[model samples]
Target: MGINAHFELGLGGFSLDAGFSAPGRGVTALFGRSGSGKSTLLRCIAGLERAPVGRLEVNGEVWQESGRGRFLPTHRRPIGYVFQEPGLFPHLSVQRNLEFGWKRIDRSRRRVAMDQAVELLGLGRLLGRAPGGLSGGERQRVAIARALLSSPELLLMDEPLAALDLASKAEILPYLERLHGELAIPVLYVSHAPDEVARLADHVVLLQEGRVIHQGGLNEALTRLDLPLARDPEAAAVVEVRVAEHDERYQLTYLDFPGGRFTISRRALTPGQRLRLRIHAQDVSVTLNRPGETSILNVFPARLREMAELNGSKLLLRLEVGDAILLARITRKSADHLGLRPGQPLFAQTKALALLN
Candidate 1:
């Protein structure tokens, strides 16, 4: 089951014509540059913007259908919205603010328990604290908890960490990760930050000029040479791996995936623990034949999937390493020197990769 949405709206000079169906369980990130209508499309899904032609359905429940004269108001939609700011009530205590949403639900309709919400968000200690006394990250955590208490079917977060400083963003991201792993309710996250999308999104809806340019699972969409992400300086591909073993002498931990295995700086990780890591395109270099000896520890046999011109100076290669796809950005000179071609056997030497914290 999934959420289906299509919206067409015109606000003055700008127009929005976007539609996409996203998974009903995990987080689906709406990713785009600023002014790309990420927020406008979200508002349309929330029924906050009455698009002239719109249709929204969540797991078979119809929220709005413009052609049938059916439109559920924002308040009636089973949604929880978290904006840039925490938006906690100024006069209320943290406990009361959470209860504001909880108390509104009748006993029979309460799917999320109050205690569970508090625990999931780590809000027990700060219940009595007023919103003003809490830090920016704390307030956001409270806002998320309050939203869950509403028993929403869909959670909408719009740049939830944009207002926070680096420290605050660091503080809140783990909690968000917990939500992504533990919660059953679906989430639609809106953010322009690539790091945020890379760390949290299981799926992506790429928007450009108010249109959905692409939509698919995170890895496929992120590494698509045609997408803008592949051309960015920070362009990278996210790969999920399981901890294989640890090398105590060398202080390294091995991670395994279908693409093969490699070791990283040892962490206090247990065998079989699963995590996602980013492999930056710039960190990858391709060779026509396997190298005899190298300082690089992560080198795997790969086949050239495709290539695209990144710019006049650089070229982007999509390499298939076993079952996984990895991106490599190399100088046009290096590509020409290697005579790269599709389906050519090659070795991808990766210099760096980092686990999503």
Candidate 2:
């Protein structure tokens, strides 16, 4: 069971007609630009706004069904909401604020224990501190810990890092990463930042003008040439890999994926540990023949799957390596010189630029 929702809302001149389904586990990102109804759709899921024509179901429970005259109020729904700012009580200490919502739940129903939440968010030392005295990142950490203590079935985060400075966002990203991996609750993270989405999301819902343009697994949606993300100059493909071995002498780590292996700078990853990596289109180079000697390490035999005109001067190539896909962006002159065509066998030299785990 997962989340299934449909909503139609009208406010002033704007209207939202959105419907989508998300897996019960892992982060499902709602991606769109400003005024695309990302926030409005999220609010609808939280029951903060009721649409005349709407329906919502979480896992097996029906939270809202306009046709059935059933609608669960905001407080009645088992959800945790985190907005841009940490809405902590200034009068209460950090521990007290966290305990406020936590105490409402029965002991028997507590899925996340207080100590676990404290440890997960690194809030143990800041228990006695007041919200006003904590730094921006610290305040947000406490806010997240507080949400965790509520034992929510679903978590909603609307750009929790948007208000934070670069340093603060950096400070909190590790803790959020831990939460993402450790928690079983599904998260609906709303953000326009591509980097954040790449780092945290397992699934994505592409939204534009109050509608879902596409929604699928992270790799599937990002690799599709027809999608806007693939057409963007900054487009990249995400691949799931696992640590296979470590070369201590060379200080390199070998990661195994569906069809090939990637060697990168040594990381402190354990054997069999899972990882996700981002490979940008521009970082990939196509060669008709495998180089006898090359400095670039992540080279593999690839089959041309598709090609599209990126612009007047450039073309985008989709190459299949093993079972996964990688994108390469090259100038029209380069494509013409190489005589690149679909179904042709070529070698792809890739440089992994970022790691997302």
Candidate 3:
């Protein structure tokens, strides 16, 4: 039971034709630039923008089907929608704002408890505060709690962080991560920021000009050199690792993945704690033979799985290390000099990696 949607709409000079299906769990991000129809697609699924020809199903429930003449009105749909701004009642206290939706659902229909919502968003401290007195991040947290109190089967977030500045976005991101970790409902998040998608999304739907260019797991979708995302200089591969050990003297933490162990600045993580790492392709270098006595601490033997020309001067190689995949971007000259080919074993070294949640 997952989401399946197809929508085609023509308004003025813009036309949108897009369809995609994603697992009904985890965070599925609708990623694209402005005017790319991310919001329009969400609206179509929510019944706010009725496309003459469209179909939508969420968690095995049919929300719309134009061909069958079945359509659920916006209010009838079981969804929690969060907009760019926290649209809380300015006059209402945070507790009452959260209860606004909670009080509307029938007791027999309630799936989410009031205390659960409050705890999940850490609203205990702000419950008595007015919306106007809360910070941007705090207000958004209240907004999300309000949405959750409705007991929705699905959550739709339309650039929830877009209106917040850098610091506010940072402040809210951990709360969003906690929500992703604790909630069971499927979340459809819309955003143009690549970092947000990389950090929060488990699956991705890449939209452009009102069409889906690609859709798949976050790691696979972001590492394809052919896509605009991978073409960026900051494009990277994401991997999950567990805390292996920590060196008190060096102030470093060791994380173990299928490929190998990664050494990074120390974090407040206990042993065996799972962490996500982003390894930039630019930070990786390819070598035919293993290097010794080098400053780079992360190196592993990898088999070249595939190669693609990224541009006139650069090439992208997809390598398999143990059970994990790593992407390396190297110059065409280096590739030619090394005579790189599929099935060949080589050493890959990384000078930088970032921990993402």
TM-scores for candidates 1 onward, in order: 0.98, 0.97, 0.96
Worst 10 residues of 1 by lDDT: 287-296
The residue pairs in collision within model 2 are none
Q: Which segments of candidate 1 are over 4 A away from where they belong?
A: none
* Model 3, position 169: C-alpha lDDT score: 92
Candidate 3 has its poorest 10 consecutive residues by lDDT at 224-233
What is the lDDT of every predicted structure here?
Answer: 0.93, 0.91, 0.91
Sort the predicted structures by lDDT, highest score first: 1, 2, 3
- How close is each model in CA RMSD to the real structure? 1.0, 1.3, 1.4
Q: Write the per-residue lDDT of candidate 1 for residues 64-126, one digit (tens) a residue.
A: 999999999999999999999988999999999999989999988887899998998899999
Clash tally for model 1: 0
In the range 68-133, model 2's lDDT, one tens digit per residue, is 999999999999999999999999999999999899999987989999999999988999999999
Clashing pairs in 1: none
Q: State the local distance difference test value for candidate 3.
A: 0.91
